[model samples]
Target: MANTPHVYVEWRGGTCRVKWWTGEYHENGRKRYESKGGFTDEDTALQHGQDKLYEIRHGINVTNRDGSTPMTQWLDTWIDSISVDHLTLVSYKSLIENHIRPFFKRKSVAEIDVMMFRAFSKKVRSVLKERSADNVIMVFSMVMDDAVKAELRKASPVERKSRRGKYERRVKEKKRPMAIEAVDQLARNTECHLGPSGSSLIWTMAMTGMRPAELYGLRREYCWPAWPASDPDREQREESAERYGADNSMPAIRVEHQVQYVNSKLTLLPPKYQSYRTLVIPDFLASMLARLLASHESDWVFPALEGGSMGSVNFDYRYWRPAADGAEAHDGPRVAKPRPALPAVPSYAGKRLYLLRHGHKEWNDEDGHSRVAVEARQGHELPGVEGVYSNVTPLMERRIMETLQARWIGLQQSRWEGAVKIDSQLFPTG
Candidate 1:
């Protein structure tokens, strides 16, 4: 007599579940039911059972999807069928379109054996050495390897050595941090056009060094204000003037939210690990931020174009690049007509807010906000550790804030004025 099969499903989380089924197996010539498979959710499990029944009846291979296929083709289907965070999707899409698809479009996934993968990897290196394409291959290899473990592939031939060279090169490059003086100069020369708000934002990046994501996510309600502790009696007299009111008030901005694009939706997240902290703010940038806040439309200190959370993509495209050109207009006292010319100062390279955040890590001595803190502020998950940790405290954050504010004002003033010129400073003579 044939035993009837049963499918079991367990809820895993939102729109996800695990599924399995029993199938007949022989143990010492005795027939018995054995668990056959596991799934992510119930609906899929029921569908899986149906598919298995059809496969058994029709003699077809029942699988989630073919693994041995062109890497490009598989990724197209993978991204479509799965739910991924917005920011991750943006990056993953870029990786596929820019690096992966172009490299693997003509290659056949089913026929891609270990030997073929090596050949493909070598070809990638030859085409673009020490570039992001090399890194793409490494990431793709891991994804492919996972498919193999999930029983999606017969095997994967990816080699660790093939990807090791690219990673090693990246590590070596990080040691050569961009010259802080050069970056500071770039900031100073460009401040005039960054606008009061824009200048404050840029300065913030240069000094305390939050990433674009962190900078864009700043809000008015998060600011911190201080009264002179030495003059307590005097502080109360000025307190009324400093307190933020309906029309004007004290200016303070704190670290609270971070901007991240998830599932194609721009959104704000709490400082990674509830890692929100405050800064003392340099007197100058603080003053600038105060002025900027007075002009803001809402509680958001620097709102986006559409009243939604601002994003780094918009920050660079709409603000930074244009402001860079404007700064070049006044770079040093113009001797003659302002002719459009590229600033001898480099654009956002190592000089970006992202790099400034790294500088913050260098100056920060507290337990919670270290280099890892910088990455977290930038909305990036720290390598080998989860996004949030229990150790980050408000005092540590406050110290970081003070460091950032002072750095912003000092670095900008120093850099823009040609204080750190490595080469002969050039200005429009016309």
Candidate 2:
């Protein structure tokens, strides 16, 4: 072959031009172009081009490679490992096919370079927020990685490039934690008016820091009036008891599994790794949970409106918010108009249930309890790389519940200035 400055080879579509510095040539006479500073000379271009093309066609690489695998194949292999209980297959499949596959499809995974990855990430960021883009990228990276593990690609170029520089902030959305005093006010004013179910709902969440899912997912078996039979913390204490001659007291709750509604079926799954652990329950909340459990139906502690499980978001919006609103004495949005009073119905009933969850998280954090404990209790793992594979433990759950109750007590007495003020009716018990 001539030492042509610009390499010319037959690609699937037609004759293609590859820069002298960056091109690949296959035994079948196909040539591919690379984004890097392509070959500066004809000889360099020809040799490198041939090497890449052969490597892509033959799956020959020192470290790892996905050259022989189509990007679609890699994606499917990667997607198989994800537990999509929280997300629907349609949504997951859409993101993979529409958003992810088109960009990387048919490209040799080994050939994906920094520039290509940067462009891919930028495009994803344009569609999703920075944080969401990061997540999408993480999924992509995981998929590509698995492809490499399966000998589909040499390694994930996206992962390598992702580690190189200051990461671009993908999502800018900020969710402000609810104000602590507002929570207290809501808790105090609403406690009495909110029926046992409602009151118990708020109290349990504020104290245990459980996610609405965990709350709804709660089974009668998890709650203990006295103490759990097989609490690891107590077992650890018992070991200490044997060594130091101290009496070991078991924990109050033994949260193991939670019910998740998938495909209209309530499937029992382990809590997020963080939430899987148990925590000690405080005396007050322990008593409350015990009583609440005593009064509950056997299957679900907090039944959804009908037999079907509720979407956590929907439940919070329709039920919890309305319940919170019922505790308020005032009518709709306050007005300075000539009207003597607003409608008899509470003003905030239309609000979503997220307010309560947000409020509870804030109250928990304000006190000395750890975020990990709260996350574990709520079945939310710490976000980022570490959350993917973590599991929950009984002891962790107990600590989370105990910490939550302690925080709830603290919130009852807290009165911070300039906070969102729910009426005194919301926190009636305090």
Candidate 3:
């Protein structure tokens, strides 16, 4: 008859109905009402209406809203809101499209739980490596986290571990550094395949710990030995010279940027961790760099065959593999003889060009350089306040350069002695 608070009861024929104002409104400013009909008595209808009112007051959407948004649609919206690096965005898109979407496409965010995630992880681990599977799970967790923030779901179901047992953690393999002998052999072979320029590139990477992308990004102007006293003056350079001194200013490469290919487009971007650094090379390597620079007309220190930014794939296929694996001569009239294989060390075989960077780290660590200095040189950010206040000092740079110079000299002597011994053996010199 009369309205009882937010609920009212009505009888139609043999059935009774109860309707309640939800105390919420649509965007058009109209009050929303929910109704449950087909009750045998007014008491039952009234009790159900009271229970729904309690749910509405406690922030539950009483319109059966759970599981309405599909996981795929929610992930699409979440990905659109992500503002990350182009490469990172590309990786996220790949994981979502290829891995995540296929499994959870039909499910809603509310329906996903820890058990579902564990099953998904099991399926992913079967197809992918441990690290790769972990990355997929991480991306999925990020999407679920955003869903929780948006109130589409109550919480993220992606747990680091299940209550029953531990999930498989990613096992990081210890990177073995290339020994001095291996480095020398690789460098000499690189020279044979790609000439002095490629040899210089490999040696530089070994000594400097620069990323392959950073090495690819190196410009003629970034080489300090090539810079004239008065040409294109920058404050950073002036400060470095003044602090480190003119005579002690060992030839160095300025690691300001990296060149990477994203979405079929070559893009030059800031180095990883935004760690713009200066890498000083020993005089021996500097001299080699100088000779290499003199022969090249292009601004790029290591240009492609046609001249411009060189791709890693191109470098690996055309230069690195052939140098390491050895190549045969074609049967053309003017074709050169087959080049002999470089020293076949198992450690060096099937290794990427980045190993030289790791070798450099080994050299630095062996030399007992400060952790901060080594990390700074490698363009890695040191954790905590030390990274904020600490910087690579002039003395530290000089010391690093000296240590590198000594190592270079020692390796050269060893190689020379080895060569002489082989010559003597071949000639049977008295």
| Model number with the top lDDT | 3
Q: Which residue runs of candidate 3 sit more than 4 Å off their true CA positions? A: 1-23, 33-67, 162-175, 227-233, 244-248, 325-338, 420-430
Q: Return the number of clashes found in candidate 1.
A: 28
Query: Could you give candidate 1's per-residue lDDT for residues 1-430 as a string of tens digits?
Result: 1123454444455543323332344577644422334455556566755556555456443243354466666777666755555555566777778766776787655556778777767777777756566677866775676556555565666766654444543454342243445454445444443434555566666554565676778765554333222223464424423433222232334565788866577688765555554334545656666677676665555555455455735666555554443333423575543433436444343233455566555555332456545554444456554544534444544556666555545655655675544234444212
Q: What's each prediction's TM-score? A: 0.55, 0.59, 0.81
Report how far residue 334 has shifted in candidate 3, in Å: 5.6
Give the TM-score comparing model 3 with the true structure, all chains together.
Answer: 0.81
Error of model 2, residue 174, in angstroms: 5.8
Model 3, span 111-193: residue lDDT tens: 88889998999999999998898899999989988887787776788886655766766566555555666666667777766
Go through the candidates in order and give each one's C-alpha lDDT.
Answer: 0.53, 0.54, 0.76
**Candidate 2's TM-score:** 0.59
- Flag the better candidate by TM-score, 1 or 2: 2
